[model samples]
Target: MESNENILEVENLKINFKTYAGTVKAIRDVSFNLKKGETLAIVGESGSGKTVTTRSIMGLLANNAVVEGGTVMFHDQDVLKMTEKQLQDLRGAKIAQIFQDPMTSLDPTMRIGRQIAEPLMVHKGMSKAKAMAQALDMMKLVGITNAENRINDYPHQFSGGMRQRIVIAIALINYPEILIADEPTTALDVTIQAQILDLMRELQNKISTSIIFITHDLGVVAGMADRVAVMYAGKIVEYGTVDEIFYNPKHPYTWGLLSSMPTLETNGDELPSIPGTPPDLLDPPTGDAFAPRNSYALKIDTEKEPPFFKVSDTHYAATWLLHPDAPKVTPPVQIVARQKQFAEMQKKLAAEKLSHPVEEEEERQ
Candidate 1:
């Protein structure tokens, strides 16, 4: 469930990396809030700064990276201002990260149980016996079977899906307040991906931790996220609720993302893809970062960057198309069709609820 209370708030966060060639502006004025116990999905292309933004929150930015401006406020404390020791204490104990590759995250030399228990011993000052006991319980909670016996097994002993579960178990062992999942399911098979997603949802309900899921897959975002933030060329181009983003998207980049997602009804020889590449960050565009790729871009988009315009109290998009004086342009045909489909589904669900009020009441009980 979602809440009104913001557990984490990022404001005007600008980040850059120093390279031999030049400075790479990775994150530019990116801001979003993660409500307590809510899942916020950050969606974008490869270099759209989805990972960078989350990494900054975890205080894992590279040494060459520069925090040009802004603040990441977690529990009223600015994360950027925290020292290395403070960051070390904050991570794992209060905030945990689950990366995409489980192989890299887990230790090959250590047994699975020891790996999971290490955090408890270091952070919570638990005895080895107590930590191992907690590790076993966590493994079971994450759906690992025969945990008492298999705890002694090495990382290589587990399958890919099992390894990922172990990684998740390790992350949740301490019941961290916030969980940063950076493309956690990208490496798994489709079936395993679904299982992992289901497990995450179940665990979230149990733990009540806020999640920031970073991924390029809009399909995954649609299912997992309570709210969506669409990033493009180091900036958040659109921010809205899941329903608003999927059914009433206002940004061209968002439309492109939605259009590219394949559906059961899709009947094309080739899937639709966004026309142009993402903007180069070494020397970002003078105007709108998405101007060159946006089909309905106005002259103003080429000349000036558009501020986020309010579509609703909760929804905002940065695009010249949202300007009142700009010519009206509808979303792509596929996107419009998807919106209609979603509307029909909602109507059907509403009708079903009205028809089966008794069942609904019983279920509530």
Candidate 2:
């Protein structure tokens, strides 16, 4: 549990896109809080508004988009209400965004070092010499080899993983307090994905910066997040600590997400995917957004929206199943089996630590 001094707070956040097709409600009443130095993962399938929600915070939406309602409060200031000058002052200074694609985010013509140092020079009034020096250090910190020499290289000179690392270096160069990473690993290979995630975690530890990690990968969420928010059709269906989400999920949508997570045991025989596609946001169903795909949907879930029912002090879920009159139902067996396996692994590690206290102490040291 983090302190009440939240680093970022989104309350009733709504984003709508006016198109010839009609107004698409990409985000509806989306609310969450990111505490200082904590990682809050926004997880969901494609078109679930995971990226859009964070984009609203960064004020990076397209021209057709409009924030219909809600407030984005950051460090005691409502960013949604801030003037363009104030927002510009905050961006790349107090906050930085890491796009999913390194190729798109990086400048092909600009030298990597200059690209990294440009934000510092523009926002922090840093001298070119000092900023370049700091940029080399940041590249090295992010695992670039011979960073001092490689600093002058262009984006094309670096490999895919290296380019991604360079992008991360630029995002962190300004030492922004809030880092928004939108599917940062989606473009990388599995091995590189692990490396990038590890680098992000290490950087977070060193800087004590808060992270808003948006990804469709449950595996990424498991490894990186302290808390999880499951979104469906522009709204959060479930929000809780990582443990609660993985072990005791209350929403059927969340259950589906956990069950569909790819595992080694799946043996490449076609990963188990969710049954139905996400609902159309432009003309969503009358009630719960997940009701169409939810196997355990009740009548109320289809006809009337379910309020977020408190499951515990820290966990809450929006589902009719949480209603007092709803029948007791257990989560799917696959999720239960996975949770058991995870618990056993934890137990084995705990026992190993107990039996080899000296090794554990030495490792900690």
Candidate 3:
């Protein structure tokens, strides 16, 4: 059951990567929250800090990376302030992540059952026999055929989709409070992708764990997410409920992302593409990073960064176009003449009423 209670809240997160070239400002003051028993989909191009943001939650950033600021509050405690021991305790037992590729996620030498059962032993201190029994049951739960016989098989024996299923089984074995699925269906075919998505939805209903779905495809997010955050240049350019983002998008980047998606009605029409590449994060842009690509760019777009303008209680976008003084009204001739006609008619009627006050009084009587 979904609730207004937030399971996790990320505020003003800033992460920088130390590179040979220079410091890369990967995440720039990004903030969003996930509601209990809901999916929050983060959509953006590659290197837009989608993966980095989730990794921060897991305390899995690289050695060279530095977290300059912000807090990831899971329930009451701040995840950022946790020690290495605390993060280790938190990772699989409370918050688990599924990587993109299933092929690389599993170990070829290890038996599939052992890998899945290992988490239970480590986290819950369950005996080997009990953990294995639980793992077998989980395998069956994830729709594995003839699970008793197949539980001992190696990771190499399973197909792409089946391996992904195993990965999910491991992630959910601990029943983590939050699941971070980093494009889990990206490698599978359309049929398999649908199956995985359906399985996730089913699991979510059963477990009621909040999910952070990271994907570049808006199509995937439409049915999956309760809310959506459209990211660009390491920042959330727009944020809203799923319906609001799809039907009433306010940001130019969101518009471009939606337009680029292939619709059923897009029969043979050329796909619309957003012009210009993303800014170099090594030296970030002064104004709006998307100004070069935004065709509706105003002078203010290049001169200053636009803050998030509230479209509704749940929807907001970072754009100067939403400003009231951004555009001036210049009424067309036809509209102006129509307004003049109405004014002249009201004046003529008033003059006649004054000239025949007795007649007006008699009519009223």
Candidate 4:
């Protein structure tokens, strides 16, 4: 059985970047923890800061980046406080990341076997021959056919799916305790995507390695993750078990996201979309950042930020709609079903002037 102990903990992690335009607040007080042997999926739209959050943990941020505050604890040591040499020792030896693009992740000039073996040779002080032997075993483990025959081939020689398997082989070469897979199957076809997901699940079970899976697809999250964290504009809006999020979501953003997902029942109906673009990070809004796009936004959402409201022991959402005095607004029909869980919450909700300034002005005019 997978232990309940936390393998990684990130608390109040705030990150920013310096550009000629201005400072971009990429991550805002983002916090989550990964339990040992658990798969935690971080889902959001593009440019929502998923990749940046993972990179910060790896200590792979760009030169212009600045961590305003927070601590990342791993094995009782603060990862943010680790020295350069210490970080070098931490990456690959204890943690490994599989980037989205396998072609760019692998070296074009080097042979496949050598690239996979390099980590073992560098981290464990193993001879090249021994590392290559282990690399061959890893190749077999990741489902590369005819490993001995293709080990010496260049990256360009393999198909996209095969290349991804090679990338996975390199990531698992050292048997690291934590794996960060950033959209590892985004570039492949549907069939190949399924294969990769299954391979990851199988490998995790065998090694008991914890995973931080980042992607925008909720479908993928359904099969891979134990917990799901929905992010919008750098903040985690709603997060809980896969069932809680898909069946009984609370936040408007979560409703929009789940409604937009194409399901088996979705055939001829028009897919719903969240109105308006995401907020500009350079000048972030003081109140709820998602209020502009959320039709369910309460007046308080525009005046002050809403803190996380407890939905259940394992579920929570950040929205003024969860406030006691807020009106009981119905979710979209498509995303509404499980009302028993929050039935008491609905009773406590009192009517309020739910309209924002524009709606009130329009009504007066």
Top candidate on TM-score is: 1
- Identify the leading candidate in terms of lDDT: 1
Query: How do the residues 29-142 of candidate 2 rate in per-residue lDDT, one tens digit apiece?
Result: 999999988999999988999888887787777899999999999978988888889989988888999999999999899999999999999998999999998998899999
RMSD of each: 1.3, 2.6, 12.2, 11.5
Better of 1 and 2 by lDDT: 1
Lowest summed-lDDT stretch of 10 residues in model 4?
A: 346-355
lDDT of 2 at 46: 89
lDDT of all the models against the reference?
A: 0.94, 0.90, 0.90, 0.91
Clash-forming residue pairs, model 4: none
TM-score of 4: 0.91
Tens digits of per-residue lDDT, candidate 1, 1-365, equal: 66899999999999999999999999999889999999999999999999999999999999999999999999999999999999999999999999999999998999999999999998999999999999999999998989988999999999889999999999999999999999999999999999999999999999999999999998998889999999999999999999999999999999999988898888866788999899889999989999899888888888999999999999999998888898988789988998898899999999999999999899999
TM-score of candidate 2 on Cα atoms, chains taken together: 0.93
lDDT of 4 by residue, 51-120 (tens): 9999988999999999999999997998999999999998998899999999999999999999999999
lDDT of 3 by residue, 99-138 (tens): 9998798988999999999999999999999999999999
Candidate 2, 216: how far from true, in Å? 0.4
Number of the candidate with higher lDDT, 1 or 4:
1
Error of 3 at 241 (Å): 0.6
